[model samples]
Target: MKQNIYNFFLMKYSREKIALLISGKASFIALFSLIIIFSFLADKFFSLSNLTNILDLSAILLLTSTAMTFILMLGSIDLSVEGIAGLTGVVGALMVKNFSNSNDYGLLSIIICILLGAIFGLLNGIIFTKLKIPSFMTTLGLGAVASGVCILSTRGYPVIITDQTIRGLAHIKLLGGVIPLLFVIAITINLLIWFVSERTILGRHVIAIGGDEAIAKDLGIKINLVKIMVFAISGAIFGLAGMLLVAKLGAGDIRNPYGLLFDSIAAPLIGGIAITGGIGKIPHAAIGAITLTILRNGMVLLGINPYIQQSVVGTIIILTVAITIERKKIGVIK
Candidate 1:
């Protein structure tokens, strides 16, 4: 009887392991399929200039998506990405040499922007935990408040930057001019995050809570603290993204981060991170970011209308969620 039971459990574990492997590989399969299709549809897709542009464009999205991965892993959402990024971009723009301001803090301004993002994220965590607000609602309200502040402070005008040093971040390329410098910076930060997720106790606790909150509580994990820390970290990345946006656009404007919320959320799901959380890795987010970037680049190359492109993203998000959501947890649709 004991041997029979051992064999039975072994069979069950093997089946589950197989399923997980297939699910993990799905994103890579989709990404390669996208590349093949786009290469044929867009003649310039393989050219150095166009490939460099894709890398450049993917940089900001990559940062934001990695941040989003943490929050999503906690079974929470952050809709304030655009708002925080916009606010920091506008602030960073005004702090540096700009047509709209007299300040020129140079590199110091970048630090301040990232710190500001952390503050905003910290506030989100405190409010959500203390007030028992839903993460989505809390982030949404805060994001709107941030956007309002950006618009009100700037009076709807973009702060055009005059700092050439910072602006060079967008123009500089590496690796035979096929990779943007910004992409390198973004990748470095993401590597640090990946380490945190894979190597730290905090990372394990995050996955623990997402997998089973009650069990995590019984395990003596400080769930609230972990959630708060994750939010603050995500916010800092948003802040950095804002600064990068200013560099790339050569200006700070509330409108500059228009599609950020969608792209950040979409990338992880596309990369095969389960919406239900606790079942993804850092590399999944990287794959997702690159895949989404390529998707957008291909759409532009194909001359698709900007409006329709949004619809495609929305469809992808819905489809990805449907496929990856934990069905047992979602017994019925409200």
Candidate 2:
């Protein structure tokens, strides 16, 4: 009887693994299909310039997604990306380089602003873990506070960035257009994140904590500290992303990119990261971010109805998560 039960469980586990493999393979197929559709519909979608445009976008979204994966892996949802990105972008614009005769702040000012974001994340983690508040509510409240700070700091106006060092990212290619320094920076950050997630004692502890917090604590893991570290890492990366956007756009609007949180969620979800946590990879989320940016860029080049883009992306996110999520882990999705 014992042997029969063990055999039955092994077969069930193998079947689930097969399903996961198929879903993981589908995301790549979706990327290829999106590309083919664009080429067939849009004459200029395959141009070299358009390809670079896609890479530029992938740079920012990838950073945001990479940050969120850490939080998601811990079975937590963080809506703080929007406010952190917006505020930090605003702060960096106001304080980095030269800004419309308003002020002249150097890279040191930028560093200070980045550190502030990390502080915000740290506060959030404390509230969520120590206070025993639900992660969702804690992050939502903290995100609002960050947004309020944005309004107060900028006084409801856009700040223009005019520093050559910062603007270098958006313009000027070295090695005669064969390579871009901006892309190098973005890819470097992603690889560093991958290394931490794949090869550190702390990283393994984090995964173990996410797998089962109760068991992890019984095994002598410092659960609170790991959770706090995850949020801090997220905030710091988002600070970098905000700075990148300022360099890219050359201006920081108070209402810029009003809905970054959705993209943050979508990228990881589409990349095969589990919403229920403990099973996603950081590098995989970058793949999803690039795939998403390609879809958006292709649609614009193809002149698909501008309004249709949001709905299409929303639909894709839902479908991808449905196919990729481990249903057994989340028996009751309310």
Candidate 3:
């Protein structure tokens, strides 16, 4: 009877099922393990205040990393997030009731900021698809252009937001102050992405393209359209992240998104998303973002040198990609 039960269980969970389970659970396991370690190392780590702080910090990173997941799944990279985010933040702040501008567009400014992000993202897709430019170079050049625009708009000054409602968004709490509204927004966006990725035809096409672009094309998947849409969606998400940052800071500076690009890219990679593509889930990226936030928070609490913290993160990213990347798919290491 035991043997039969064991055989039945084996039949219920095939190799693919087991692999998927591992991939999905790995990030959570790592997160919990770190939590345990940090709890022991830092007395304040498990405190409610510190935990809330970690979640607060994780919000922006979580959003950006979620955006990056789509592009990364297609085996492409986006280097434009930081610049786009900074530009959007500046635009959002300037359009709203602000110190630098008389225009009080209020909610319209938020929509405009998101639209601007989408437009830039669309530009990325057009240039890459129509011009035959590689995503790496295309996004890099576009990011630079965005950065220049941001500087030109601000003229080396920060714009202080005067919209009380917008500024208050950063402070709203939920669930007895254990959760911030910003975190709620981030999670909601992630859930939307998850639904699209797991339920829609576009999601299937995306996965197909990532698995093998050549095969996807042969199978009649609209590669260019899908890629463009992915980029545009990513851009919109980054734009929202920028606005959130501005709301939190109550001001918009061109330097606001300084380290976002790295954090977004690193989070997914650390979460075991293969850089080679086609092998990750949205939840994994979230887990990775939370883990990174915890790591940074713990480091600060433990009095670790800031420089060393960066080095440690970089090393972990390298090791993660080395271990998780499917080298066979890449064909060559350049």
Candidate 4:
């Protein structure tokens, strides 16, 4: 007994739980470690200019991942981010930059685009919960539908920016610094997500529903309403992402980084959101997003091929899930 007790504290697994909670998922520790390592291997990787550049790059993924964190927390997943964001971006760009040059409504256009995204969320929820269809297949099918809308809207053409007001967001500096307004918007959205996930009754319901539907129902929670609301929330955020993307890139290319849904999910999973649902926090995935953006951006500067980048991301995702997922929570892998 004495030997066993001593060995437990001396063992590597003892600090594992604490580390997992503090900074494990999304390899937060590894990100910092790499920051130090790369500061030496590569020039100016840690310089203020380069660091600001990394933050700017991370904002988009963080925005998407934060919304994704909500969906995953409910033990649900939305694979439709790419299509939704793409649609939102194209719509917003066209609304503000029509060839007639009469489409400018400024910030109101942002609000309308966001609401449109929420409509998609509502559609996903109603189709899944009301129709009694599984969300997995529902989102997959809707993704295709949304993608088709993108094709029809742009006809495969990218929307260019003539609106100086919208373009200013992408180029303007905060306090005369390199920190674009884009990162600020992304971070603000994430702060709101943290509030919703941590402070409200609906947030509690989301956690409960994800953890166990039967149990949540037994507790008299409005399981269906909560589930539906989350999908809408995810959609609304994606809508904001669309507007932001257009502002950031000054164009709405149908085939743009709109296909980043995989990385969005991968970020949350790596940050320790259980695939089974009801088991993770929004902030965790946000951190994971930054970590991933760091890794990818670093890889780019290091001249790594983009194809191999996906492979590396895939490996990290598998390993993160293997280490962090509570497999017993899931009854079957299928």
What is the C-alpha local distance difference test score of each model? 0.87, 0.76, 0.85, 0.78
**Model 1 off-target regions past 4 Å?**
1-20
> Which residue pairs show collisions in model 2?
none
Which ten-residue region of model 3 has the weakest summed lDDT? 5-14
Which candidate tops lDDT? 1
Per-residue lDDT over 230-314 for candidate 2, one digit per residue giving the tens place of the 0 to 100 score: 8888888877777777778887654665667888889888887777666667876777888898888888876779689989999
Question: Alpha carbon lDDT of residue 67, candidate 2?
Answer: 84
lDDT for 59 (candidate 1):
93
- Per-residue lDDT tens digits for candidate 3, residues 1-334, read 5334333433443442454466567778778988999999999999999998999999999999998988888888889999999999999999888888698888777778888989999999889888999998999999899989989988968999999889988899899999999999998998899888877777776766766788678666799999999999999998898899999999888889999989999999888777767778777788899999999999999999999999999998998787666656766778
Ranking by TM-score: 3, 1, 4, 2
Lowest-sum lDDT 10-residue window in model 2: 2-11
- Give each prediction's root-mean-square deviation over alpha carbons: 4.4, 4.7, 5.5, 6.5
lDDT of 2: 0.76
- Candidate with maximal TM-score: 3
Q: Compute each candidate's TM-score over C-alphas.
A: 0.93, 0.89, 0.93, 0.90
